[model samples]
Target chain A: AQSVTQLDSHVSVSEGTPVLLRCNYSSSYSPSLFWYVQHPNKGLQLLLKYTSAATLVKGINGFEAEFKKSETSFHLTKPSAHMSDAAEYFCVVIHTGTTSKLTFGTGTRLQVTL
Target chain B: GAGVSQSPSNKVTEKGKDVELRCDPISGHTALYWYRQSLGQGLEFLIYFQGNSAPDKSGLPSDRFSAERTGGSVSTLTIQRTQQEDSAVYLCASSVRTSRDNEQFFGPGTRLTVL
Candidate 1:
C-alpha cells in the first residue's frame, strides 16, 4: 500500500519570505514523489518530482523539495514567497502496483500575505 | 497541441439521475485515469485505462460507476442512479505511458452537483 500525508493543512507566509510545506509518505517499495499546485478553478500543475534521481529536486516557480529517505519526508520550500504563490498544494505518491496510480495528500493551502 | 479537456464543466442533476462525464486526453497519450475530488477532500482514484482496455477498475467506489474509453482518445464515465454522495469534481488525466516517472497532465474537470 502507498499513502501520503501533508503535515500542515494551512500555511501562512508573508510575501518575500520563505515558504515551507511538509509531506510524508509510506510505501512498500521505492516511491516516486511529486508536488502539484492548484489554483482556484484551475487544473493541477506539477511543481516538482522526486524519482530517486536526486535528494533535492527543483521545480517551476522557484519551488523545490528535498526527499529525505531516513525521515520518509518530502518537504517543499521556496526561498521567497510571492503573492501569486498562494494556492493549494498537494503531495502525491505514485503507487507501482498492477497499474500505476497516484495517491494524493489532503493538501496544504498556502496563504501569501503582504 | 492541446492538453486534456473535459466536457460539461458544471452539471446540476437531481438524485437518482444518471450522468455521463467525458474526457479528451492529450494526443498520443496512451494512459488515462479518472479521479473524484469531494469538497475539501483529497482525490479518489476511480479507474485507469491503457488504450481501449482497462486493467484496473478496483478504484471504482461502486458497481454503478462505469467508464469506457474509445479509440484510445476519449473516455466517458457513467454513473447510474447517482446519489448525493456522488457529487464531486471529476478529474481526468493522461500520460504518454503508465510509468512512475511519466507525469500526468490533468484537465479542468467536470463539477457534478447532485440535488
Candidate 2:
C-alpha cells in the first residue's frame, strides 16, 4: 500500500518570500510522487513529479521539489512566492502494479500575502 | 489540443434521486479514471477504465455508484438513490497508457449537491 501525508494544512507567506510545503510517503515498492496545484474552482494542474530520476525536480511557476529517499519526504519549495501562487496543493503517490491509481494527501493550502 | 471535459458543471438534487455525470477524455487516450472530492474526504478514487479490459472498481464507496466508458471515449458515472453524503465534486482524468510517465490530465469537475 502507498500513501502520502502533507505535513502542513496551511502555510502563509508574504509575497517575494520563500515557500515550503512538506510531504512524506509510505510505499512498499518504489513510488512515483507528484505535486499538483489547484486554483479556486479550477481543475488540478500538475506542478511536478519524481519517478526516481533526479533528486531535484523543477516544475512550472518556479516551483520545485526534492525527493529525499532517506527522509521519505518530497518537499515542495519556491524561492520567491508570488501572489498568484496562492492555491491548494496536493501530494500524491502511486506504486507499480496498482493500475496507476493515485493515493493523495489531505492537501496544503498556500496563502501568499503582500 | 483539448483536455478532458465534464458536463453539468453543477447539479442540485434532493436525497434519493439518481444523478449521472459525464466525462470526455482526451483524444486517443486509453486510460480513464473517476475520483471524488469532499470536505471530509480530500480525494478518493472511484474507478478506472483502460481499453477493453475490465474496469477496476475497488475504490467505489458503495454499490449505488456505477460507471461505464462507451466505445473507449466518453464515460458516465451513475449514482442511484443518492444520499446527502454523496454530495461532492466528481473529477475525471485520462492518460495515455502507452507511456510509463502516468500523467493524467484532469477535468474541471462537476459539483453535486444533495439536499
Candidate 3:
C-alpha cells in the first residue's frame, strides 16, 4: 500500500518570509508525487509533480519541492510567501503499480499574513 | 481547450433520496476519476474509468455508490439512498491517459448536502 503523510495541518507565515510544508510517503514501488493547492471553494490546482526524472521540481507561483528518497520525503518550499498564497495544500502519491491509484494526504492549510 | 466540467455545482437532497453527479472530461482524454472530499478529510478515490476497459471500482465505499462513463466521454456518479453521513464535495478529474506522469485536471466539484 502507498500513502502520504502531511507533517503539519496548518502553517502560517508573514508576507515575504520563507514557507515550508513537509510531507512523507510510504510506497512499495517507485512512486509519483504531486503538490496541489486549492483556494476557498475552488477546485484543486496542480503545483508540481515529481516523476523520478529529477530530485528537485519547480512549480507555479514560485513554489518548489525536492524529492528525497532516503528520507521518504517530498517537502514543498517557497522563497517568499505572498498574501495570495494562503490556501490549502495537498500532497499526493501514485504508486507505480498497474492501477497507479492516487493517494492523498490530509492537507496543510497555509495562512499568509501581511 | 476546455478543462473538465461538472454539473450541479451544488446539490441538496433529503436523506434517502437519490442523486446523480455529472462530469465531462477534456476532449480526447481517456481517463476519468471520481473522488469524495469530506470536511477536513483528504480526497478519497471512488472510481476510475479508462477508455472502454472495465472500470476500477474498488475504491467505492458501498453499494449505494456507482458510476458510469457513457460512450467514453461524459460520466455520471449515482448515489442511491443517500444518508447524512454521505454529504460531501464530489470531485471529478480527468487525465490524458492512465499513467504515472499524466496530470489529472480537476473540475469545480459538486457540493452535496444531505438533509
iRMSD for every model: 0.8, 1.9, 1.1
Of the two candidates 1 and 2, the one with more favorable DockQ, higher being better, is 1
Candidate 2 lDDT over A7-95, as tens digits, reads 99999999999999999999887789999999999999999999989999999999999999899999999999999999999999864
The digit string of per-residue lDDT tens for model 2 on B1-115 reads 9999999999999999999999999999999999999999989899999999999999999999999999999999999999999999999999998333679899999999999
lDDT of 1 by residue, B17-114 (tens): 99999999999999999999997566989899987564589889999999999888899999999999999999999999999999999999999999
Error of 3 at A10 (Å): 0.4
Determine which window of 10 residues in candidate 3 chain A has minimal summed lDDT: A94-103
The DockQ figures for the candidates are 0.83, 0.62, 0.75
lDDT of 1 by residue, A19-78 (tens): 999999998888999999999999998999999998999999999999998999999999
Residue B86 lDDT, candidate 1, scale 0-100: 93
lDDT of 3 by residue, A1-114 (tens): 899999999999999999999999998877899999999999999999999998999999999999999999999999999999999999999857555668899999999998
Backbone clash pairs for candidate 1 read none
Each prediction's Cα lDDT score? 0.93, 0.93, 0.94
Kindly provide the TM-score of model 2 when superposed on the true structure, using C-alpha atoms.
0.98
For model 1, the docking class works out as high
Q: Which ten residues in a row have the lowest lDDT in candidate 2 chain B?
A: B96-105
> What is model 2's DockQ versus the real complex?
0.62
